[model samples]
Target: MDWYPNSDEQLLLRTSARFATGMAPAVSGARWFRDLERGDVQGELTGWPPGPTYQLRSAGDKAARRTGRALLVGIPLVANLIANLGGASGTPLGDVPGRGKPDEPENEVHDFPVMWAAPGSLARTVPWQLDPGRRPEDCVTDLVLTDRRLLFLATRKGSLAKADILGEFARDAVAEVRRMKFSEVNADVRVTFTDGSWVRLSVGNPDNAERLGQVLGGAVRMLAESELSEGQFDRVARFRADLPKTAHPPTYSRLRSGVTLVESRIPVKAGSGLFETHSILMDDSGQPAEPAPGDL
Candidate 1:
């Protein structure tokens, strides 16, 4: 019989040659290719068009399937498994309670909490006497800031089931929110309540740490300037805690070139009971040099 090349046969030949030559280095390092080179040709065909060419085509098809599986099936499964294993995970937006749906009526604006527990850790912790049944590892918690309160809710890890109500500090109970440096690029925050209970939390990123400081600092300033009863003022003053002496007030000025400059001070530790100032700059239109998205 005389041999004649069909379109499929001709294209396959071209593709096989191109891929083998172009990917020689990578393919040569593969065990399959090494085995083929070592004369293991029973499972891998030998000869033209039906040999290495066929093997290459089959391998390509398998690689495509593996990539697709990784994207469509493997990733989500692995993520879910990790979350269930008490690795870091966040609640889905849809699952968050009392935050109205798209069509529902909006409540008054409430800022998100500045710092909370990292994923895989307990949301809040109390003395063992307070809750003998709860262990830090078994719970995950979120800190929420509402107009009325700074709330901490602990939930069972891997599920949103309520585990315990850790603490709820009304705005009046907040004594101070201090930014403590942990590293050059990261910080931890401490929230002191009037009752003397305090919580320290890690802020995962520097930007978030700064925003937390700004928002809480601004809130304290606003409260200080507002008209309040003597009792109310004392409560708010607890949250202020000499912030005016430790941190410089934000300032605004216009340059001769018409670019407005806004300056603010951030506190960094100098020594025991001492802090130095770090300057932050922003434009008059309210854009910071380094963008602080949710900061006031």
Candidate 2:
């Protein structure tokens, strides 16, 4: 559980961050080009474009290669517009790479207010180094949540390099964590700071993304192995015994109804550097049970 933020800090949650360029939160949507850099949530759409996106469009690559990539990125030009039009809330919103005019120039700004800080907020200070658009292809980043702080770590992808602690913020600095179900596979989260500034982040794993929201937002109570009752402990032990050796240790949490949810992550069989979560719910009798109302 030790991390760059603090040795001995309990590692509450960790998730793989966006790796492909298509997962960028700065992509255009209904909130395109909205600047939150000055903490002005209603400010004009004058946000600065991410430089790396522009670099891709520079005279370096062949015209055909650039055009081909653009089509892959722009076909929809804003899929969420259908769901979020008129500034109303929607659910199960699909994911978007970048959205704009079908032939939108690559140099244009595509910042969404949820992901771009207008000003004077903590999100504005998030290091560009964590941005996939700006980082190297083999680099990997992780957003780590612990009892004391929230931070990002950088590591060389598929390498043995030690993870580097890039940046961190005191837990108190976070004011809210919202699950954005509208995203593709329901894997996006909006992290808001105490000053009313927020940034949208896409966790590569949907289960991890939901866990980050539920735990950080206080919607459910996370429990440790020691907190389990004798019966529950035995059930969990047997469950873990049957999991693959590569499976991560199970995490326990209790809903308001006291139903225990135990979940674990295991590597995908394809070994494609991805993971999926497996979860089970138990009642007080330590028997598998269906989720209770409001327990989801």
Candidate 3:
């Protein structure tokens, strides 16, 4: 199996560093990809989707069952965590039909640590830890889907679930920010940011400045009525308009988008109840790390 990490995986590790604390040094492209190509990454990437071989219906049936458990449980979630974790396995298959040629038998399972965490659950956070050999179930981080990218915690516990605050500010350069429009009714839409900023916009016809608060939610604090100002609006319309493409094969498919697409279960929000969905890009980590928002 190839031990070198592909270009995309390297991007994942670097971008992920903004969120994961105590992450191991970046794995070399060769050795890293080698482990993954050899299926050794399955042990590293807890809850990661199996390879293309298992992606086929005939092979993926069992995988679907394991991921389906989230729907049945109250706090169902999935996350891709990077850490100093380790595992063990037994005997690597020799001459499997589709598996090129056989290599040395890996009859035992071994585990090591890496950097990067992409979980899909609200219960967990960024900068968290995952010991696949121990608690594999709690490695998920909840994500709120934006127009193109997925929003998750930067740190596992109490820090910002979003990535670096400076990163968001830089995102304005790319114009991925979008503001909801409202004319008649009060939008009442809440804006949240990763830096603990939140604000209620369109509570009334007051002014557009109040709406700006919505875009930077989760980062700055909610503004008081007295603090609100129309001049406060940053007219970042250009930034909101230039978001990256989410097409099947993205526009810049050549930058070696390290994110590996997975057909995993995603818990979509449906009013009061949540449902599991078997869809592509369910929790893909191959997204590149632009100077803007979270890579994933």
The best candidate in terms of lDDT: 2
Candidate 3 stretches with Cα past 4 Å from truth are 1-36, 41-230, 233-296
Candidate number that wins on TM-score, 1 or 3: 1
Error of 3 at 2 (Å): 40
lDDT of each: 0.31, 0.58, 0.22
- Model 1, span 187-225: residue lDDT tens: 345565665444445333233344445545553122212
Give all candidate RMSDs, comma-separated. Answer: 28.5, 9.5, 22.0
lDDT (Cα) of model 3: 0.22
If scored against the real structure, what TM-score would every candidate get?
0.30, 0.66, 0.18
The whole-model C-alpha lDDT of candidate 2 against the native structure comes to 0.58
For candidate 2, the 10 contiguous residues with the lowest summed lDDT are 83-92
Work out how many backbone clashes candidate 2 has: 12
Sequence-dependent TM-score of model 1: 0.30
